[model samples]
Target: MTKSTKPAAKKPAASKAAPKSSKAVAAPAPAEANKVAKTQIIDMVASATTLSKKQAAEAVSSMLDLIATALKDGKSVGLPGLGTLSVAATAERQGVRPGTSDKITIPAGKKVRFKVASTLKGTL
Candidate 1:
């Protein structure tokens, strides 16, 4: 009788398992830090134009309200160089339930869509 002398192969580590370290996690990158908020935009507009902070805030708020109202009325809102916001109708579809083996159905819904203008794309 002949005897085989082969070592068993080792199993690979699980990809889902994360390292259990106590070190502090790193913060998001600088680009994310540079994101401008609504208040900052208002301040910029106030400084650039002949308007106070309160006036700038009111203007910004009114503009947003107008856009939202137009969209709610099933109309498209357009900003000259920015883009257009339109409402789109979606059909009903099927989806799976998370953490379980059961399936579910997702109802039809309306969604907002944005189309970037070529002028803005060139600036980017």
Candidate 2:
């Protein structure tokens, strides 16, 4: 009788580990982002004109203050390169619960609106 050789069993391939969840990712600090944004704006202004960093900062601050004042007085302010800031009136109306259909009355209020400039609109 001839001796028969048995085939060796093959081992299963190892499974790859799952990737880390999105929650495990770290987000950038808010303060750092704010500083970067401010610096970028200042740099852009300074580069576009002869103004120094300090002058650009002051000019931006003043423009923001002016917009705030106009809104506070219920007036509209429009910026050529930025947008228009205006106060919009809302009318009181009957409202309903999104899922349950429960009826209610929504009170009228004033809201601030912004319409972007044509140049900015083109970018979007």
Candidate no. 2 TM-score: 0.55
lDDT of 1 at 79: 92
- Candidate 2 lDDT tens digits, 1-124: 1233222222222222223333344354544655657668888998999999999999988877888988989999988988998999999999998999999999999899999999999988
Model-by-model lDDT, in order?
0.84, 0.80
Task: Report the lDDT tens digits of candidate 1 across residue range 1-124.
Answer: 1233222221123322333222223345555678988899899999999999999999999998999999999999989999999999999999998899578989999999999999999999
Model 2 alpha-carbon drift over 4 Å, by segment: 1-36, 97-101, 117-124
Q: What TM-score, to 2 decimals, does candidate 1 have?
A: 0.73
- Candidate 2 residue 58 C-alpha distance from true site, Å: 2.2
Candidate 2 whole-model C-alpha lDDT, 0 to 1: 0.80
